[model samples]
Target: MASNTSLSSLSILIALLFLTNCQAARHLLEETPEVESPPHPTIPTLPKPELPPVPEEPTIPKVELPPLPVEPTVPKVELPPLPEIPKVELPPKPSIPSIPKVELPPVPSIPKVELPPKP
Candidate 1:
């Protein structure tokens, strides 16, 4: 894709041209010795040519534009009042049945057995 190079180069060229002109003007000013305008015999002044008077700035009197007609109040759109939210009656929780305790039978004691003496 071609890049927009004209603006970049133009700006750079403009800067260079500006610097060159400035340098040239500076050198001319610095090198030129100050000399007073040579005095000459007085000459009669020429009549200033009449320029048509700068046309009177047309007095565009601030036309009091009739106040912008008040925007007709848009009647507030009344949405049919949202149907009243229904109160939900939640069913009562069923009572949990009480668990019956079971009594465990007592464990029987085991008889001790004597073993024959090992050789």
Candidate 2:
């Protein structure tokens, strides 16, 4: 990826150098004398034609609708009462036994070893 980006940048730099060299090498010709142009004839204006007015649209007739009838009321219905459920008592949970703690013996100390002197 890095090599590709660097190659593209190098190509762009060479192209710009080439274009600048080409533009600098070009030579412009000397200026020529200007000639006067002939005068144009004026044209007479003609009157514009008149257009006819657009026709009016016809109106639609109104329609009458019949009134809607009233709805009848419904009588209320009575339902039977539901029976009550009996409650049950649960047994008590058993207690856990306590464990007794034992004393640990002391650890023995490690003896130190003598080292030789460095040369």
Candidate 3:
């Protein structure tokens, strides 16, 4: 890649030399005047080119499109009447018995437990 870049630069230098030589040759030699000027020749007058006046920009027209038709709606459906459920009459719950109040006996006192001496 580096070699290719250097080669291109060398070729450009050669082309520039050719261009400079051609310019130098034209400067070194001048052709004799075909006719002597009377101090100065009458300057030629040229008519300026006539360009057409720019046309006015056109205006954009707006087009109105009709609104799209509405879609058909499906009627709401009602389910068939639910089958009449038989009245479920559960038997009345048995009445709870009233408990009689009773007094309990006091807990007995335990004698002091003693540990025997180890030999």
Candidate 4:
């Protein structure tokens, strides 16, 4: 019961605070007059400074090179012929035996069951 009363008092205090804030806001909105703001000041423009021109690059001289020497030719040597190899005969592979087939018995069927009617 004490907690309930404290909760109720807290809720009432919050409601009163909200109502007072709303009333103050309504008074400010209705009573205050609109005023014009002062214009912004303009800044003066500054002149740009002049710069000196760049100097030209110096020219380079060309150089000449001596000619290369010629290469000498070489003669190829001849080789003797190789001996011929004899032919060889190979044996034939044996055939694999066939496997016999296996037979299995059939599975038995399950019997059906009936339940009694509900009361």
Highest-TM-score candidate: 4
The CA-based lDDT of model 2 is what?
A: 0.81
lDDT of 3 at 107: 89
lDDT of each: 0.90, 0.81, 0.89, 0.87
Give stretches of model 1 more than 4 Å off: 1-81
Q: Is candidate 1 or candidate 4 better by lDDT?
A: 1
TM-score for each candidate, following the candidate numbering: 0.29, 0.30, 0.28, 0.40
Positional deviation of 94 in candidate 1, in angstroms?
1.4
**Tens digits of lDDT, candidate 4, 29-114:** 99999888999888888888887888888877766676776777677767788788877777887888888878778888889888
Over the stretch 1-119, how does candidate 1's per-residue lDDT look in tens digits?
A: 54579778878999999999999999999999999988898999999998887866777778676777777888888778778898999999999999999999999999999999999
Sort order, TM-score high to low: 4, 2, 1, 3
**TM-score, candidate number 2:** 0.30
RMSD of each candidate relative to the true structure: 28.0, 13.5, 30.8, 10.9
Which is the winner by lDDT between candidate 2 and candidate 4? 4
Per-residue lDDT for 55 in model 3? 100
lDDT of 3 at 58: 97
12 Cα displacement, candidate 4 (Å): 1.6
Report residue 84 deviation for candidate 1 (angstroms): 3.2
Task: State the TM-score for model 3.
Answer: 0.28
After TM-score superposition, the amount by which residue 60's alpha carbon in candidate 2 deviates from its true location, in angstroms, is: 18
> Tens-digit lDDT track for model 3 on 1-119?
56988999999999999999998887766553456557766799999999999999999998999999999999999989999999999999999999998888998999999999998
Where's the lowest-lDDT run of ten residues in candidate 4? 62-71
